[model samples]
Target: MQRTADRLLREPLDCYDDGAIEEGDLSVIRLALEQFHHAVADRRAVIGTGSTDIPPMQARQT
Candidate 1:
């Protein structure tokens, strides 16, 4: 899934550099993004939120 996400990101830029993208290409790009979204959600579930490890920010006086 990570590889798919990387490919979708890199290939489209390469395609745009070469020439204009067609409807078919746009459809594939959209689908790839949807798949990547799901992949990220799955990863987040496995990793859980690490927010608790971060220290609270202190406000600075002007």
Candidate 2:
């Protein structure tokens, strides 16, 4: 999954503008990428824990 995230981050921004995406479309893409980055970070944090260690809870208090 990190590999996929790397690919996403490395991809050319021009690719997203190929069809003249509207402002709303660009916003959506930005949000998606941000979410993807967060998920990748969370996955890495979990995997960094040693086999004998428990993964940390990630829930936020409201």
Instruction: Record all residue pairs in model 2 with backbone atoms less than 3 Å apart, i.e. clashing.
Output: none
lDDT of 1 at 20: 67
Runs in model 2 deviating more than 4 A are 1-19, 49-62
TM-score of model number 1: 0.46
lDDT of 1 by residue, 1-62 (tens): 65866675777756755666654665666665666666666676778943323233332232
Clash-forming residue pairs, model 1 = none
lDDT (Cα atoms) of all candidates against the true structure: 0.59, 0.54
Q: What's every prediction's RMSD, in angstroms?
A: 11.3, 9.5
Tell me the tens digit of each residue's lDDT in model 2 across 1-62. Answer: 74875586444445444544443555655666667666766676888942333335332232
Q: Candidate 2 — worst ten consecutive residues by lDDT sum?
A: 53-62
What's model 1's lDDT at 1?
A: 64
**What residue runs in model 1 are displaced by over 4 Å at the alpha carbon?**
1-19, 50-62
